[model samples]
Target: MSIATLSATPPPPSSRAARRTGRLFALTGAFVGVVYGYDTGSISGALVFLSRDFHLTEVEKGLVNSILVCGSIVGALIGGKLADALGRKAAMLIVAGSYAVFVALSALAPNVVVLDLVRFLLGVAIGISIVAAPLYVAESTPARIRGASVAAYQVATVAGIVITYFVNWGLSGGGHWRWMLGLSALPAALVLIPLLRLPDTPRWYVLKGRTERAVEVMAMTDPDVDPRAEVAAVSAALAEESGGSARSLLRKPYARAAFFVVGLGFFCQITGINAVTYYSPQIFEEMGFTGDGQNFLLPSFVQLASLAATVLAILVIDRLGRRVVLLCGIGTMVMMLAVLTAVFGTGELSGATTWIGFGAILLFTAAFNFGFGSLIWVYASEAFPAQLRSTGASVMLTADLVANLLIAQFFPSLMAWAGAARTFAGLAALALAALVFASATAPETKGRQLEEIQGYWRNGGRWPVAPEPREVSPGPLSPTGPAGCAERGA
Candidate 1:
């Protein structure tokens, strides 16, 4: 297949089968999100009880949270390579099984050291899942609905968070944090059964030179399309990719895309979303919501708001495009954070001021979920060529995990040292940076075919340059001046 033979348009799918396959993949892949959400959310409520049981100091408590993040960083670093080597389905299966085992182990931990080790191991699964699940969805699904399909994973994540909050609320009375952490393992086990049966993506098969298998999966995934054509197109695109290496990503077009993705990943965490999610109870307590019911209820409301906004993103992402939604969401977050900073910075918290802070935090939650939260995975999944997609997504996810680790370790102390207002204000500054970055560098990948998107960066980070102009002989309307110069009608 030649460059000229490459089609900018994605091959059309049999509507019914495509929809079926897409929905199935989206739902099953979302188990990754479920594990992530439960892991991240369960700790917030569990930490309170864990602290009491272990007589933990503040720094020790922070370690319990930060160790998972450090594990996630390690996971993200290795996950891409694992996915590429083992295939996406296998990687996800490994992640699910790990989640099941490690989460259960976490519940049984006798000391903070053991708990930290288990949680960190779980984080590695999380890091691998985040990369593999989205990569599978991106590679398997049709381009037309890719954004929403990928965003569905996030919806599952938010749903998992919401479910954990309710679990936290229900169990808070008994101080049964063990049960709270143990509950996540059940879902992890359930998701694994389906993942075990799922097929590796057609693209991955093609990458492995198994064209017959690729065609078979493609037919099942999109029955109306000519499997041969689809396979050939993917093969042609793969042929153009340089030998897959971390070094290749550092050069030219991949480097440019990497910068944008890594920046987004950093900003996503530094903007304080995770800090708020992980420490919502702490934040609420500081806001004068000391009652047990108030402590659990408020964070539920925040997660609910986040879940709703993620649904909204799913509806409009492909239509509104990635850049528009990202800028709007980040801009909204910055504004809400500004409100929070102003309310908290001035003085003591009154009832009215507390309500204002609550409102601002909820709005910020909605805005972050509506924009960057949903789109970051979508963007990372599609930005690189198929050959490097998994590795590329891993790189970006690793950046996100790195940011998460920093925020997790220091956010509490930062809040203590700087005060809530200044801490939020600092996040607002990061949000502002995110908004600017999205506006200037984020690619508009709303409806483009993956190959078409790869083509954008194939020529060393710029669109292919047009050919040089050729000289034209003087025409009837032309006026000749010096030597051989010719002027046209103009």
Candidate 2:
């Protein structure tokens, strides 16, 4: 733990034990994902009953859903600098504690305005974690399994959403909206215990001029490689680097990474995922699945589809590569959104015919999870040079939340005024733009070291790829495909 030397350190553990510790470290940091999924998804069902309880009108509903995002933007602004200063593990601990307190406050609010205020505070907590968790995962895990490791946050998010759906369906008979919102506090508090035990990431330690500690952490988390060499490489990369300031990200070397991160994060939100997440029950009602618990039950299935696709995404993200998954996922979304747009536009959706809309949404949810939802964290975590990683992610996530705020705050009113058909059409057009933008801009990060990825942006946006090591022969590991893990060494 000393900054000057490893004099107090014990001998390193067995490779198997060290690897387990590393995996545990990644998942513990990722556990904040539950707050992201459960808190956000809970409102979808809770909003149904809470609206009736508060006598909320359409605009109030939008305000209730969106106020959290406003707080999130503020949190995003602060999160990067906080993480850089306090370290990733310490930042996550604070975020987790905030979720436990604010969400409980949210559940106990006396009025609609109070609820919005508490939820906004909860949003600040979520925003801060959104910046820290992916950065922590990317730093703690090895490049070989980095995609799936980062995907752990998304997997936890989707899983939390799925679990929230079931909780909502169960509570729908009683109309217990408060119980649904309050339940998130339990997991939030529980996550804190594990997070307390995990070490701060090696990259954070390196940035603080604590290379000895970084070496110790690297050996624990990445047993497959030489820890000292890895730390040395990171140190060299940081030698000329200054602080991870917002202004630094605007310089020419960082611009490409900034654009890709910002564009992907914005499109991820603007293409209408939150519109679905925040109001799936309402959408189901408009399509005639009304007045029964079926509205709640149906979204459970949609969440399941998303959860399953996320699982598939974790399996292939390291193999199929980032660009392929993003393009394919966003492309499928455009088609599905277009189909729903046409169906609703033509007034062809009645009783059983409404099932067509259900199927399309199911596919759409699956596609969203399979690509954009799952991998955005990977790209966000790895795209920048280490010095600006936190700042870059914060800005990208701020754009994402701004888009989310626009959607969450206005989608209900938009649905009332423009109808679902026109809404879906707008989303579909944005999806098309997202697909094309990703095709033109996204660069591959599969099996590449964080240091290796940094060189890509510096080298005029071309990959500064190194050759593969001879010892790791050509073959698939559990996640790597037949082509084997790519050249990971420098």
Candidate 3:
């Protein structure tokens, strides 16, 4: 594919009305992200206060933190199917409301048991948001700008983490962990307000056999433009298709694609991003940052770094392409992990070495955002044939949430036994494996149309049909060909 072909699909043009409405979609998605970030990061600060208030042991505190991850496993496994079946808009509204209600209840809980249950329920809501918001955005966005659009989810997530850190810092000082937990509800409530006006995915409308409705929805997403081209594209892809069934994902045509997406999901969580994103402050303190205030201040920068890296990714991804970015990022992560291992293992680690370790952490975050963080969702959505896209996404998210559960449940213990430095090293090794797999097998999709990417790996990674011509055509071959073609008549 030529660069021009990949760059041609511009974001949907908007009328003043549609432009206003688009903000509502963005705000609602951001609210969902805020809730996700809060649930994941809130425990980092509150763990100390909660331990004191409840007289909790270290193991129990870890378990409390792990409960949500466990619940996320089940929630992620089923959330996609539920969205596809019940409708993305309906599922999000229900989840947004329930997420708020249950999380607020957790804030009021008197004991660890109640708190654990609340965390578990909150995880389910988060799991739902993870799948729903991206799917909604992907279905809504035009192919040209889809990468930037869905990346808005990660931006919201990072923002949520930063805000929660500040909130926890301010509130936890006054024995206000309950308020810390309860304040999460504010964003959840706000998300629902705009969700009431948000349109359903045009793809979902196609699935439901609502052709006219689908076109109507598509038009609203880009009111200044005609929907005919977009509608016809989806319709042609879905021709002879019923609404995609879950079982279809396991069939021969889709099974490999399904596995690829699921593996992508698994690799995403296994990179130990959550271990850092959720627990970085705790990890920093353990690494011997004695001052509480400094530890808190440092992680906010990490969040900032993550957001900046993702923005960079959006700019370069279509240009550099996916495989190159994933390999380069993961390779750098391994090097950083190796440095972290040496730094922490030496009892002499202090001053300069500590600063180096800190720098390594920042580098790792930047690398992850550039690759796994950005590409996983993009690849998962585009990898499958249209008939199985939703099912493949559902399966992919299940693997991700499952890995999330394992890491959340055991990472503290792993740190306890293996130490944070070594644990990071292990994650780095896993990242290396993902890099190898990606390099050896993943196809380049930089300039290909989303619908065309399904066949990317076939024909030895060349399009069977010659890609859009990159050079101007020579005049029809003369009997003796052109002078340049004859090399100046040699």
Candidate 4:
């Protein structure tokens, strides 16, 4: 295949079809984000009320939060195979439905055991969403704006987190934890509505040997382009990587990539992002932000800041590129966490100190948004060979949830036992290490197609410079191919 053959024969630029296709793909992230945010954010306020109503001890309260993460670990492990078997769109819709049903059922739980079980089920949906949705977006989108389109997922997540705060604050006044928990179902339900209109991933269709359907889906997802070459490319990549066994992750070349991705996922959470995001108000109260109840406002700002950072990342991801942005973001987070540790180490620092501490937190949120939050899932989905993409996503995200579970379960107790200064400072050290790891190991993925990335990983940092557009041949007809695939334009 030659470059000319893979060149997108887009409909007239004057046509509106491409824009519509782009919008649809972008919204997939938005829907996914809302659901993710609601599930996570709703828990805090609900847990507060439940602890009061059910007289939960500190350990029990932690259990309520940690149980979901446990379920997520299980879901992420299996999610890849499900995506491979069911097709990305179908898998996502099924997860959404499962999330809705379980969340609603949680509202009716009569005891802690039942509540924990229901919450665990909800976690499965969350885990599945983390893997399948991103894979779908990566496979469905063209490369040029791939960062921005898929970024909608992160943006949506931040939005979901912020909106749930508003929902929790509104319902908290009435002491309706059930309403807070139940409110999550709305986003899940809404996601399902639009999902009915979405097309399956072209890669998945091709893997199933439905090239004609893959072409049609490409047209619907990017109508301005003739998808024949892209379809052919996807078909070839699927053929080369057809055995979707989870154990294959430990085999040659893939083994190293899997290690890094799983490390990245686990480290992303161990930074204590979820700890604060999940329990911000409690932390603020400990800092002495008293009963003005302005604590609710903290997470909203964090979410908004995160959203802004994600937008910035989208613009520069293909420009300044992934490794640089991650360095900057994680480095900033380390510095902010240091300041946080210093402030909290002083023991009962309140008022201005508390506000400064919060300022430091906002910076951390910005850093995460720009760096790990945006890149983690994107890289996880794209960094692997086609055969291992889904399974790799599953393994990495499962590791992520395990870290999430640990932090969510023991963080409050750790704060009490270790003191705020030591706890945050420890997290700061982890962030520093993450920054170093990213600089030493992460590759520049800007403008490279997914196929180009495969060679980048396979060569272990000695990968060749990408071919100039004019000199490039179309090469193979896989998703990772030099031409005819999403990476060609990326």
> What is candidate 2's TM-score against the reference?
0.85
Using lDDT, give the best candidate's number: 2
The global C-alpha lDDT for each of the candidates, from Candidate 1 onward, is: 0.81, 0.84, 0.74, 0.78
Off by over 4 Å in 3: 1-14, 140-147, 199-206, 209-216, 227-256, 450-452, 458-490
Candidate 2: segments with Cα more than 4 A from true spot: 1-9, 141-146, 209-234, 240-244, 248-257, 381-383, 443-490
lDDT of 4 by residue, 1-490 (tens): 3323444543433336656675776686568767887888788767767877788876777888999998888777778778889988888898889978998999888888899999998888887777787777777776666766666777777888878877777775677889888977866878787788877877788777676666667766665456787777666666777676768878876777787898898888988898877787777777767652467667668777877887888788778888888889899999999999988988788768988898888889889888988788778877887678767877777778888898889887787788888889889999988887777778778788987788777777556665554444444544455344556655
Clashes of each: 0, 0, 0, 13
Clash count for candidate 1 is 0
Candidate 3 lDDT for residue 32: 81
Tens digits of per-residue lDDT for model 3 on 221-328?
766555656766776766744467768766665566666778878988887877776567667777667665667677777777877887888888889998888777
Candidate 1 C-alpha lDDT tens digits along 152-222:
77788898999888888888888889998999888888987777766888888887877777776777676
**TM-score of each predicted structure versus truth:** 0.85, 0.85, 0.84, 0.85
Ranking of predictions according to lDDT: 2, 1, 4, 3
